[model samples]
Target chain A: MTSSAMQQLYQQIILDHAKSANGAVAELAALDADAATAASAAGVRLAQSHQVNTTCGDEITVRVGLSGTGADARIDEFAWRGAGCSISMASASVLNDTVRGTTVAESEAMLDLFREMLRSRGTIEPDEEVLGDAAAFAGVSKYPARVKCAMLPWVAFEAALLQLAEPA
Target chain B: MTFVAPPPAPARDPSDQTPSDHAQTDQPLTDRSGSDLTLSSDEVLRIRNDFPVLHQLVNGHPLAYLDSGATSQNPISVMEAEQEYYEQRNAAVHRGAHTLAFAATEVFEAARATVAAFVGAAENEIVWTSNATEGVNLVSYAFSNASLGLGGPAATRFRLGTGDEIVVTEMEHHSNLIPWQQLALRTGATLRFIPVRADGTLDMTAAGEILNPRTRLLAVTHASNVVGTINPIDDLVAMAHAVDALVFLDACQSAPHLALDLTALGVDFAVFSGHKMLGPTGIGVLYGKAELLAAMPPFLTGGSMITTVDMQGAEFLAPPQRFEAGTQRISQAIALASAVDYLSHTGMHRIRTREAELGRRLVEGVTAIPGVRLLGPGLGVERIGLAAVDVAGVHAHDVGQFLDEAGIAVRVGHHCAQPLHKKLGVTASTRASTYLYTTDDEVDRFLAVLAEVAPFFGVSR
Candidate 1:
């Protein structure tokens, strides 16, 4: 009864978020204690931080590193693991991989494009080659409420950027 | 006067009056018609024994009911009232000259009088509907019909068109909100709501802004079902009246706890449920001002509600009979009247006082327990007989489970006020409600069990 765009919002991205969150402590629990602590400590110095989806408790811990030689910082390591629905976990995993080599400015640009795509705010066509695996979530932008679940990680990434500016 | 019991002073507070106190229990209850006031603990306990559902094991424990806000346990007298009517006088009322039909009609009309006297509304102003939801919808539907000029002079009272606003509060139940929304959608009217303050009270400033000259009707709850906050309706009523806006009260929560005087309150319409007032379900009462009732169009039609029928069209009967269409909930209405009699026998003042005491105890006990955050104001005295709390770091569903295992029943989730809960910064909260039948021992047991379970659930100080 609803539009295909609406169907896309409830896509695998949100179902995955609810079913298998990719950055939760469950994944951390699988790692060696030393490695987990190392990752957490490494993240503490980064301007960006982790944020949890309160509605379903999915989380994403984002970290950004500036090369000092360039105007934009590189996403040095975008590793995440959590317990949630498959779509959320898969989306978080793919997001971490996709943003790793991308510059801070491009990431910001992509984040803008991603939000618009998810909301069906207007006509948005994601470049398949550039969007990579994140494009699998293109259909998910249709469900207004579910868009939050798909975009939770990206919002955390933005929050991380703000923190970078503040050095917290 | 044989076995002279005191005259039941329907509105008087008996605590300060000594002579009336003695007469309350002086007369033998054998005569059901006798208006008694002094119901002792033993007698009240015996009366409780008559309700079969009260004695039961829920979740492998003695069911300590703490959710009367959802619904009340009905007594035998009320239950039998329905059966008695069906057995003896089950025919359609306000029609037919047969003896059974006349008797049924008399009983039905008398039930209306009983409910009217209970809420201090005139008998002719009472309209029976399926439930409180229907009662509210009836008014909205009637207003929509009236705006279309259906009931002539009566229709003029409800005429709302473009620029007319329907005022409600954020704390309204969905039953109260959705109908007004649909009415607004149907009419070109605007639907506005008063926001809740930080402590769950109405944001009067927002209310003032919302209820201006454009406001045609104001519908709000007398109490919050989730937060347990008794709203300041007197000010709201006065404010609506200042702008000549008609006021309709959703008395679902208040009817069971506080004594209501609809006429004295000066509200145009008041709707409440029989089931919530310790009566049977499937019956609700709608009290409209006599003039307004005379003017409003009938919501439902067909059968006994007709005055004179012709080939072209039909003239409807007066006030209640006009509103009531098809076969009524005859037994349920009679039983609801009997429930009113029960409340009268207990004396509402005494019930109110006792529940306040119980509320205080419940709040104090819950507050003393670490990690329990009381949600509403006036810990015990500040609210009606309900209390809601957010147990720190624990999901409300978990808290509810822990309490259920302790033999204490509570309501969880957003309590059908999703937006209100979101505003209060919680997805859900646990609530325990009290009633006239609730005792001090039950409150103590609840506290003892909560303390024992909170620790087990890793809830720390």
Candidate 2:
């Protein structure tokens, strides 16, 4: 007796992504967590951002590294480790796959679109051309509480990038 | 309904009354909480009808609100009481010269007297704060003021310093815990807590060691907002009093569900929020013993609380007024009195009896569901009508969303008790708390839905 909205919100695609995210935890743990603070002589650096949804106690930490500087900068390493609901974890997993090879500017644009889609309140159909698997979260916008759960990872991604942009 | 003010309760014990007497001689300190007068299923349905919001549908199914622990839904009478006041008797009280003003002040005092009588305190002993959080902060800051040499010689007992200790329990909501922690930080006193066992009951053996001579204040919840463990307040009050320490009960969870005779409870100070008890949001009550409130300095000082004013200084009014220092929550207070009337007319002991049955049902049902772990004391132990549980492999947020889709509204999170959740080895939990209006069928629906939770998440349990 699940409603259409609930099915749309927790689709098979999202559940699959969440299962993969749990599997990726061991791989994510192997990354140099300390690299977030220590930058080498290379112009690019690894940055990490830890975010929590205080309302529900969901927590996620995103770690990302860049391959170069300026316009040519490409996302080299993207990994996350956290404990939360399916929506948040699936979102992190989807974002990790979608943004890993894209340039930094493209990732930022994708994040902005994802955020706007979540705030659309079920009016704006998610542009899957940009969001990829992240588009599965379009139904989440109808629920103001769950929208935060969906956006948690992308916000962390932006924060990690912002940290990398800062003069190290 | 026209409200009548009850006579003020006399504080019978002397200021130096012995701790053992407060604990032992008052009555048998055993479990007097279990009342045999249970509400019938049809009577509960009638009670449910009184709450207009309970008859609604959400997500194409009937709404079953199990989040009364967060905020109880108001009955029709409580809502109408606030509306009637605004429509007919709206005026600024305690300062106006008009006829409406006089009327408003009279009704406002009547509300105070009603709430005071409900909690077994003198009318002058209750001070209105915005919420229970503000009430705790008010006392903490008043202690800070006293430590800084305010309230003159009468306030000397309120001071805390390097050697003083402020004790609290491990299960307190952050509203109760953080204020004391900050007060300790401000006054350089040591902050200690009596730990909770795996069963969610307070470790009384450890409690014996924690409450000692240096303990200046012992703040604990009358009942846990999370796990629904009703603390042994009589024994705790006795132990704290034995050390000559002040006791403050956070009755936010208890006052709404229990028959609270705060005088008989023997705590020095206590607080409960009005909204959780079916009143409006902007009003809360802080109950203190008459002498302690008389000696304490004001927390918020302004016009309504003053007696005389000069350019340099002003003399403060007594007790409640000294603490109430603004235009105040007038209609909210009236609405709260109406809520008190509703509860009193309904009978607090009957409500208690009904909730105990509901609590047992919740515990039994959830515990029977494989992979669901109940937080508080189990079957054969007494608790209020609530249960918080951790479902194996499914996150609480997901559980909440699933329940929402089923039109079963519940509270999901650490429930403002992160430390206790941490001690229980979880970041969040799903809590289903009931009130008098909650039906037996609704409890069954919750259990049925909860059984589907782990399986829906594809977890094998």
Best candidate, DockQ: 2
* Model 1 C-alpha lDDT per residue in residues B1-461, reported as the tens digit of each score: 12222222222244653222322353445344232443345544556565667678865667888889888998765666677666656887766877777777777778788889988988988999999999999999999899888998747869989998999888888888999999999999999989997788899988888889889999999888987777888999999999999999999998888788888888899899999998998999998998888888988888878889999999988888889889988889888887888787666766666667677887888889888877766563367777788777555654565666556787776677766877778767878887876766777877776665445434466
True contacts kept of 2: 0.78
Weakest ten-residue segment in model 2 chain B by summed lDDT: B20-29
Structure candidate 2, residue pairs in collision: none
Identify the runs in model 2 with alpha carbons over 4 angstroms from their true place.
A22-44, A127-130, A166-168, B1-36
The per-residue C-alpha lDDT of model 1 at residue A26 equals: 41
Candidate 2 chain A lowest-lDDT run of ten? A22-31
Docking class for model 2 is medium
Query: Least accurate stretch of 10 residues (summed lDDT) in model 1 chain B?
Result: B1-10
TM-scores for all candidates: the values are 0.69, 0.92
